[model samples]
Target: MNPPNVQYISECFIKPKSSADEDETKQPIIHLAPWDVAMLSSHYIQKGLLFVKPSSMNDQENTVQPLLEKLKESLSLTLAHFYPLAGRLATSKQESPPHYSVYIDNNNSPGARFIHAAVNLTVSDILSPVDVPLVVQSFFDHDRAINHDGHTLSLLSIQVTQLIDGIFIGCSINHVVVDGTSYWHFFNAWSDIFMTNNSSISRPPPVLNRYSHVLNLPFTHHDQFVGRYEAPPLRERIFHLSAESVAKLKGKANGECQTNRISSLQSVSALIWRCITRTRRLPYDQETSCRMAVNNRTRIEPPLPEGYFGNSLQIVRGIAKAGELLEQGLGWAAWRLREAVANHTDKAVREWMEEWLQKPFTYQLGRFFDPCSVMVGSSPRFEMFGNEFGMGRAVAIRSGYANKFDGKVTTYPGYEGGGSMDLEVCLLPESMRDLESDREFMDAVCI
Candidate 1:
């Protein structure tokens, strides 16, 4: 099959419908916390949902154009609550070595970029294939932009592509500005406004205040982490785990460890880690790791508000020797993962923040590119298919071509909506082929 061509229709910057008090001349300059600064080296988080057009639109003369206008209008209102997303990153080198911060000049906000495009493919063209089609990458803007690029580029970019029988809404959010949780928060809010035909969002508004007590240091490592990352040739595939399969894995994990504490995520992570390590054929003595992004909102002493926005994540890892990890079976591996999460307590979070302040460093993608390492991102807990933007619920979810590397895994709630999950795994060409054919790995995967 030929790659679907996306023809651009129009492009515009959609600013917030409402601004801050006009009398205030100085806009708030939000400084980046240690956690936010750590993502300076990462790429934008690109995700999208595929929705089949509502049956009511079958008789409309112009379906997509009107929907595009509605989306843009609702997005403008949504920006009122998430105003910082419409702003840009600013840096001042005069401060000895320079520091980075988000400058929301509401009066002159650049606004989020909105692009309208059309593709000649159906939703099945994207969701039917075992391997996601490369053309799907064209649905998103900022294909290779990193979080640092937010300084010059739009902090957020939304693309609405009109498919033959459906529509795809793709968003590219700066990783430095928000993590996966906040990303979906904004998405849900936008959809709510559109679905209800209300200008104001009914959901919990985002809390924009920075958590200052955690880190009192300034972010001055701008130049140290500025560059474009070129990922090597990689193949991406989504593996589905049914609710029953997940339960079985969880049961097996708990039974082996003689405990019932291992969660479904830990069990799944353990399974992937072991499968990838075994497929890579690493040495028995090689140390392999499974890194998971832990949300710090609830891990701190005084938990940040559920609506608290911005980056508040810490990467925790479960490390074990390759031979021991596979030999111990699934339960032992899951126990290691669970222990990693349990160890990242409030004290551990604060200590890590303090250490980062003293000697600042950013997360380099190379650390996760290690063949023996697997990094799990995104979560099934997110409202993946719940964003009903007046049209309908999302039938499927997909990610764009940013930040993908070997052993990178993104988890999403399956469309079936139970405890089911979809693991979007990226790996080297050869390793992916081996994994597809590996009987042990394929046995747990649901068709």
Candidate 2:
């Protein structure tokens, strides 16, 4: 495929469409929760691009300007409910403290940046398999993609690129402020506002009280965490597991167990974990583990409201020896994954947060490579197809450079409600090459 040539058109700051004049006196400083602070060291922005092909008649009738106008208007209206996205990040002191804990200064209203561009390419050019790294580096805004200093943050920025065949709506959201679910919530709401042309009927008010349970922790811990670690060299690629493959994995996993059917997530994760352990050829006795990110919204006591928006997530890890994962059947690995997930009860989440508060600078150093660990992030359950944004459903979804770390993986559902999965796997070049050639792994993956 030919390299895409993109031309920038215009850029602007988008603020809330409506604001209350009398509410200017409200508290502007939103403190960071311990959970939120842990993400301050995150250098990669959660990047996603949605591809859509408008109907022929609509495509011919609506030019770029009209579509962009509608998007900006709808985005502004959507921001009114998710007001934190419009705010900026700042430290509490003049000079940075040990770990300058950051806060969202809502009073300043930094606003999200919106950009318009035109690319001399087609939807197929990207959707088709290609050098994913080159494509991501070319298309995304890497300069400000991740929060480096915690001193400044765009919070959210969006780019609407007009391709020859269709349009791509790419967005970069700061990880410290929101997770995948929260990001989609804001996006779907924006889509609703535009499609229905009625802000009141589009999205219900998001519950902002979700942060009330967060324990206030010092920001300096962010500096400590960032200072303590350096990322290893890594490469990323997207692999697809078809519905058939996923079903087979589940069946195989279930067959190995006397009872207890593993979930699709556990099945798939177990397959990948076993493959990675085999591909790396780790020693049988070497300890191996999978740290899976779990959503705590429903798991917490008196569960958070469905619309509660914030970073309500925890990392639960399953540990086993390398031999145990590779030598055993699929069910064994799946059971480990399931058990780790089961242990993260509401009480467990609360305890985890408290522990972080007590030792802000601590790191889960064991979670990284000696080539025996993988951190599984995101889930296939998120409704990526629902991010229509006034256009047709997205044909494909992708991750940004933020996922550039060894032993990191992300999963999204296959296209159009399919039960298949798209796994974004990042690892050291050698490990990736080995995994690519592993016959058993390659056989199950969509070619």
Candidate 3:
């Protein structure tokens, strides 16, 4: 399919309209935790959902204007609760103890960017394709901007694309401010405000306070964390695994191990790891790794509040030799992943935090560029299909061109609304072609 032309109609900044009575002169500065600082070099998180226009609207030609008005208005109300997004990242100029903070001076603040665009395409143009169209990347702002760019750029940017028969709402959020959990929390809250026509979110409001235990460390040599990341040429494809396939994988994994502790996620992660290793044709004795992002909300000594709104994640890696991984079958790989997750306890998290303070470092794109490794991000358990903003449930979900590299895999719940899963796999062009033709891998993929 040809790339559709996206005509930008207008753009403006949407400021937060607070519902609470507070002094604008003394807005608190939010401090960044170690987990948050670790993502400074990574790109902004870009995600969006596709919604069909409702049949209740009578005006055809004037529909988009009203929809844009409603979205912008509700976004203002949503930002009142998520005010940090309306601010920018500020760094202290001192050379000794580098300080990074999110500064929100309510008196004078640069608001989040809201863009309105029109696309001459249909819902089928996005959802019906075997591979997601490259044009989908245009639905979002801040194409390749990293989180560090928030120092000069908007911490949050939203784009609402009007299609012929649908709407696409995409967001680019600074990863230093929030992780995947917080990302979806804000999304669901915004949808709730719009759906209920309320000035405040219906769900429990987000806890904006920084974690108390994380020490404010003076991170040196911060120059490495600020810059644009240029990724290699790659191909992105979504592979679907139905409920039956997931169950079969779980059963097979557990059967091989003669235990029922292995979960559907671990099973599927193992399957992808092995398939990618085979497709890459790595040396038999080469050491390969699978890194999974684990949410640390529940893994800490004192659990964070229910809606703790910040980065509370840790990446746990499971390593094995290429030959052992492919030869031992699925269950062994699943067990290795399970062991990795189980080992990331409260003690481990605290130890890592302490170590990070001693030697501060951020995740660079090179860390994930290896064909012999896979980094699994996002989660199938997120409420991807629940963002109903008065139109209907989202028909599909898509992402932009940020933080994408070979061996990067993101998981989402299938739109089928079952236990089905969708894996958005990014790989080199040649390896992608090889994986698509691999019978063992393609057998589990649903059309």
Model 1, 1-447: lDDT tens digits are 587589988899998876455225323566677788778778999999999977766633376668888999999988878878988876544465543443333344568999988888888888888898898889999888888788788989999988878889999999988999999999999988888878777777788877453333355556656656688988989899999999999999999999999999999999999999988998999999999999999999999998988899988999999999888899999999999999999999999987887887777776535767999989999997889787667888999999888999999999898999999999998999999988867999987
Alpha carbon deviation, residue 55, candidate 1 (Å): 3.4
Candidate 1 lowest-lDDT run of ten? 99-108
Model 2, CA-based lDDT: 0.72
1-447 per-residue lDDT for model 3 (tens digits):
477689998999998877447336225677778888888889999999999878765336576777788888999889888888888877644454554433333334578999998788888988887778888999999988888888788888999988888889999999999999999999998888888899877787888887454344454445745555687888898889998999999999999999999889999999999999888898889999999999999999798888998899999988999988999989999999989999999999999988888887788886545668998999999998999887878888899999888898999999886789999999999999999998878999897
lDDT for every model?
0.85, 0.72, 0.85
Identify the runs in model 2 with alpha carbons over 4 angstroms from their true place: 1-5, 19-27, 55-62, 94-101, 130-133, 142-145, 148-150, 201-204, 210-234, 362-370
**TM-score of candidate 3 relative to the true fold:** 0.94
Please list the residue runs of candidate 1 whose C-alpha ends up more than 4 Å from where it truly belongs after superposition: 19-27, 58-61, 95-108, 211-221
TM per candidate: 0.94, 0.88, 0.94
What's the lDDT for residue 252 in model 1? Answer: 96
Q: Per-residue alpha-carbon lDDT of model 2 for 312-380, expressed as tens digits? A: 887787889998777788899998898889888988988887777678642233333345778888888
